[model samples]
Target: MTEKNKTTNNGTSRRDFLKSASMAAAGFMIVPRHVLGGRGFIAPSDMLNVAGIGAGGKGQSDIAAFAKSGKANIAYLCDVDDRRAAASRASFPKAKYIKDWRDLLEKEHKNFDAVSVSTPDHNHAIIAYHAMQLGKHVYVQKPLTHDIWEARLLTEAAKKFKVVTQMGNQGASNDGTRLMAEWYDADLIGDVHTVYCWTNRPVWPQGIQWPTNKSEVPKELDWDLWQGTAPRKEYVDKLVPFNWRGWWDYGTGALGDMGCHLVEAPFRVLGIQYVKDVQASVGSVYVDEFKKGVFPESCPPSSHITLTFPKTNKTKGDVTLHWMDGGIQPERPDELGPSEPWGGEEGNGTLFIGTKGKMFASTYSDAATLLPKERTKDAKAPQKYKRVPGGANGHYAQWVEACIAGYGKMEVSSPFEVAGPLTEALLMANLAVRGHDLKGGALKYTWDNKAMKVTNFDAVNKYVKREYPAGFELKA
Candidate 1:
C-alpha cells in the first residue's frame, strides 16, 4: 500500500485515483504533479505540503491545526511581522520561513500543494487568488475578501483554477449546523423565513478617526507587504495583529469578523443565495461639543442591518436575515426562561423563525434550542446530514483531506462557491452601513446581484469594486 493510501484508509490513494481519473475522464494529458516544478508539486508520499501565508495569531493556530490533521506537512511559513510569526516558526521548526507571501509563492510555490491564508481582511483576496492561480488549493479566513469585487473574483478563480478551496468559518463544519439542517429538513423548523445572527464583536476599536500620529513601523514588521492591495498608509500604533479588524482599509468591521461564523448556519439551513436588498441603522458616536460623529473610515460603534435574500428550495418566500453587532442583540424569544443565558456568553446568538416554530443556536451554531425549550427537550428528527468528523474543530482536517482527494472530488462545508456569496451578502449589508452617510441618509439599498451594483443608489456603487493600488491588480 502506498503511504498516502494508508492515511486515507480507503484502500485507494486519492492522488493516484485523481491522476488516473483525470486522464481517463478528460481523455487528454493533464499535467501531473511531477511536471509542476514551478507551481505546486505533490510529494511521492501523498502528503500535502502546505504554506502558511500569515503565520501568526489565527494563521499560527491554523498551521498548527493543519499540522495536527496528519495529512498535511507545514512546509513554509510567511508573515509580514516576525513577531507574529514567532510561535508558528517555533512549532514548525523544520518549515522554511519568509517575510513576504509574494516572495514565498514566487520562489517556493513548487514546494507546497496548498496555501492557508489568514491575513487581515484587506489582504485575503490577493494572496488566495494568487495561490489558486498557481494551482494550489487555498483555505482563506473569513469573510472571504476585503471588498465585494474581490469575493466575486476569487469565487470565479476557484472554478477556473480547479483547485480545492475552503473558508476559515469553522462553524460551517460543526455538528450543530448539521443538526439545524436536519431539523429544518424534517420540518421541525418549517420553512424558516427569518434569521437573526448577532455578535458582540469589535472587541477591537471602531467608530473612531484614524490615529493622527503615525507611529514607527515595528522593526520586525514589513509594513509594505502587510499593506498589500489596500492603499498604503503610514503605520499606526498597535494595528498589526488584531486591531485591523475595525478599519475600512484593513478590515470589514464586525460583520466581516463574525458574519461568516454567525451567518453560515442560516445560509445553509435556508439555502440562501445572493442578497436582493439591504437596509441598515447604525449607532452614532459622540464626537465632542454638540455633534454626532460619523467616522467613515472606521466601522460604526454598533449596527442593525437587515438583509433580504431571494427564496430558495427551503423557503416559501423571501428570507430576511438580521445582523446585529457591537454588543447589540435582538429581543429574547419567549421560548426560553427569562433567566436563561442566550447564544454566546458574550450575548451573541442566532435565531430562526419558521412557520411551524422557531429555533435558536448559540454562537458558531453551537447548542441549538427549539422554541419553548420543551420542544428542544422533546425534539426528534432523523439525522439527515452526516456530521463532519470532529465538528467545528474538524474544519482544518476536512480541507486537508479534500485537497489530497483533489478538487471536485470531496465535499467541504464552506468551499469558495459557498463562502463567496456568503461574503457578498455580508459586504452587501456593509454597503448600507457605509452608504448611510451618502444620499442624505438613504434608508434602503436595492442590490442587483447579477449586476453586482446598487440600482437605487448610484453613489454607493463606487464601493462595489475598489481600486487596487499600483502593481496590485487582480491578475490571471
Candidate 2:
C-alpha cells in the first residue's frame, strides 16, 4: 500500500497528492478527493491542507483550536481585524496572514485542504461557498447563516462538492449535546412536547433606530470589509470588535448567537422540525448615539418567541419551543425541583416538558442532571439514549482528521446535514421575531429545504437575500 493509503488524516499528504499530480503533468485543478479515492486506497490525509478566514471571536478561537490540533498543522490565519489577526497569528508565526480573505482563497488557498470561517453569520455562507468551490472543506461557525437561504446554499455545496464540514458551535460536540439527544431517545423525558430555551443576547448592541448620517467610523477597523455582504454604513465604535451581535445587518441577535448552542440539544436529540407557527414580542431597546439602522429602528431588548412544530407526515408528534433572550426567560415553572426553589430560572438551558416526567438543564448541560436528581439515579437508561460512539475529542481536531482522511467518518456530529438544519431553525426564529414586528401577529412558515427560504412570505423575501457593501462580495 502507498504511504498515503495507511496514514491517518492529518492533511500533510495533500502536498504529496498535488506534487505527484504536478509531476504527472495531469493539469489537475483540485478534484474532490472521493474521485481519486474510488480508484485507489487514498486516505483523507492525502488531502489535508488548511487556511482560515475571520480569525476573531469564534474565528480566532477556531484558529486557536487548529493550532492545538494534532491531526493537521496550521497553514494560514486570515482575519479582517488587525488586532484580532495579530493576536491569533501570535502562536503560529509561520502561518500566512492577509486582510482580505479572497486573496488567500483565490491565490494561495490551494495550499489548504480546509478552511474554518468564524466570521459573523452574514458572511458565513459566502466565504464558505467560495471555499468549497475551490475544493477545500469548510468549518463555519454556528447559527450557520444570517439568513435561511445561505444555510441551504452552504449545506448543498458541501454535498455537491463532497467536502467535509462542521459548524463552529463547538458546543455541539459537548457531552451535553449528546446527553440531551440520548435522553430524548431513552424516553428519559417521555414524549417531550414543549421546550424553553433562552440566552442573554443583545449582549452587544440593540435597539437601533433607522440609520442617521452622523456616526464616525473607527480608525482601527476596515469598516468596508467588515460590512462585507451587508449594505454600506458609516463605521461606528459601537459596532466594532464585538458588539454587532445585536444588529440585523451584522449579527443574528440573541437567536442567531445562542440558538445554535442552546437550542441545539432539542433539535438533535428530539428530532424537532417543521416549526410552522411562530408568535413573538420584541422588547424595548436603543441604538447608540452614533449608530443607527444597523439594528432594527425600534427593537426589543428582550423578546419571547413561541415556535410550534406541526405533526406533519414525518413528525412523530407536535413540539413547541419557546425562546427568551436578554434576561427574559419563559416564566419559571413553579414545579422544578419541588424541593428546590419554585419559579426557578432556567438561566440558559432547555427544560423538557415531557409526558412521563421532566428534565431541567443548562445550556452547558452536556452532563446535565435531571430535576428531582433522585429520579435520575433511580431511572434506567434505554437503547436510543445509548451513548453515541466516537469523537468525544475536540471539534477542530475532528475536522483536521476529516480533512486529512477525506472520507472515513465523514459524518461528524455537526456535519452540514445536522448543523445546517439547526442553523435554519435558529434563523427562522429570527425571521419570526421580525415577522412579529411587521406582521403584527404570529408568522407562519414552511421549511422547503430545497428553496432555502420560507415557502411563504412574498414581501419578506427581501429579508432572505443579503446585499453586500462596496468591494467585498461573495466570490464566484
Candidate 3:
C-alpha cells in the first residue's frame, strides 16, 4: 500500500477507515443523492468544499465549473501569480487565498474536502500526491505529470490511497468517444491497426534558444513557488500565463497540451494500455545560415512521433499511433472527398484507419464521423456504451458529486487508472521527442515500461525520471 493510504492526516489508515465506515454503513443506511434527491441533485448542506491550487487561467475555468455545479463551494484559492489569479479571486470572494500550494495543503487541507491542481506539468505530481496523502479527493489537469516515472507513481498511488481521483481530460466524458466506441465495437471500423493524431500547437514560441536577457520576476508573482520542482532559473520575459507550454522544464509541449484530448479517443476505442517503443523526427529552427540551432531547454517547433502499442483485443495486431504537432498533419485519406474538411478546421484531430474502414474525430472526441462521406451518411450502430450527461462539460460536476459521494461510490470518466497509462504514453512519446536532441545521429528508443527507461538510449533515460529540486521530492 502507498504511504498515503497507510496513514492519513486523521491518523486513520484507509483500511481502518474502510473497516469502520463499512461497519457504520451496515447500521446506518446512507442514501445516495441520485436516490434521495435525484440525478444532478445535491443538498446545500452536503456541498463539497473545494480548494483550488493554481487557481487561474484553466484553473480558473475549472474551479468556476465546480461552482456552477452549485454543489461545490470554492473554499480556498491558491496561485503563485496574483496577476493571473485576480479574476478567480474576484469570482470566489469568500475563498481564503494563499500563494504556495504547500502552505494551502498543509494548513487548510481540512478546510476543503478536495483539491484541484492545474499547475504546470513539472509540479503536478507532487501537489496532487500530497493532497491525496491528506485523504482529499483530487482533480488534476492532464498530461498528469512531467515524467514517465511520475505518471506511473501517481497511477499506483491513486489505487493504493483508495481516494477518488480524476484527470482533467474532459473529453473522456464526451459522447463522441462513446459514439466512436459503439461504432468500433460494432466493427464499423474493424480492427484499427493504425491511428493518426495531429495538432497545430506550440502556437507559442518553441524550437528556439532560451532568451539571453532574463526579465525581472513580477512582484505579484512568487517565482520560487512557480518554479516548484524545476531547478531554480532566472525568470524570463513573458514566461507566465501560457508560453510555458513550449519549454521542456515547465510544459509538455504540444503533445502535453493537446494529446490527452486528441489521443484519448483512440485509447478508449482501441483499449491501448502501454506503449512499447517510440521514434520521432522534430522540426529544427535556423539560427543563421552558418549554424544549426540547438536548444535543449525548449520543445521543437514541430514533431512527428510514432508509438507502437502491443496488440489488444480490439486490434488484429500491434497498433502504430502517429502523433504530429506544430501544423504538421497527415495526408488526406482517398475516401475523404476533395472538398471535405480533414481533421477539422481547428487544425487538430484523430483518424483511425482500420482494416474495413476509417473513422475520424475532432479534438476532445467531438464531431466524430466515419470517412468516405457516403459511409458516414449510411452508417448506423447500436449504442453499447452509456453517455456521460452533458458530455465534456460534465467532467467538473462529475468530480464534485463523486467527491461528496465518497470514494468507490461514484464513477468518473477519466479516473487515474485510465488517464495514467494514457499520460505515460504521451510522456513516453515525449521521451523520444527529447531524445531527438541527443548528439547521436538517430535511433528508435525501445521502452522498458516496467523499468521506466529507454532501453536503447541510456543517456535519454535521464529525462524519464528527472531530479527534483530540494524539498520537492515525489514520494511513493
lDDT of candidate 2 at residue 325, scale 0 to 100: 88
Q: Identify the runs in model 3 with alpha carbons over 4 angstroms from their true place.
A: 1-45
- Candidate 2 segments whose C-alpha is farther than 4 A from its true place: 1-28, 31-47, 210-220, 285-299, 312-315, 334-346, 382-393, 442-457, 469-476
Which pairs of residues collide in model 3?
none
What digit string (tens of lDDT, one per residue) describes model 2 on residues 214-290? Answer: 67655445666667777765665556677777677778888887788777777766776546656677775324566
**Candidate 3's C-alpha lDDT?**
0.84
Error of 3 at 370 (Å): 0.4
**In model 3, which range of ten residues has the least summed lDDT?**
9-18
Relative to the unseen true structure, what is the C-alpha lDDT of residue 265 in candidate 3, on a scale of 0 to 100?
94
Model 2 TM-score (2 dp): 0.82
Best by lDDT: 3
Q: In model 3, what lDDT does residue 46 have?
A: 80
Q: What lDDT tens digits, residue by residue, belong to model 3 across residues 1-476?
A: 44554433222223433233324323443343344542333443489878899888899999999999988988899998998889999999988899867657654554567889999989899888877766778999998989888888888878877778999999999999999998899999888999999998979999988888978878898777788788878889888888998999999999999999999998999999899988899998888998879899999999999999999988889999999999999999999777878776889999999989999998898888997766777788998888887899999999888888788988899999999999999998988888877863267889887888888789988988899764565656
lDDT-based ranking, best first? 3, 1, 2
**Candidate 1 lDDT over residue span 1-476, tens digit each:** 34553213112222332233223323322345566654345552477789999888899889999989888988899998899999999999888998867557655665678899999998898888877777889999989998898899999989988999999999999998888888898898787888899998879989999999979888898777678778778889988789999888889999998999999998889899799889999988888888998788888889999999998988899999999998888888877788987687866789999989998888789988888777887789898887899998999999999988898998999999999999999999999999976742556788888899999888888888888764455543
Q: Identify the superior model by TM-score, candidate 2 or candidate 3.
A: 3
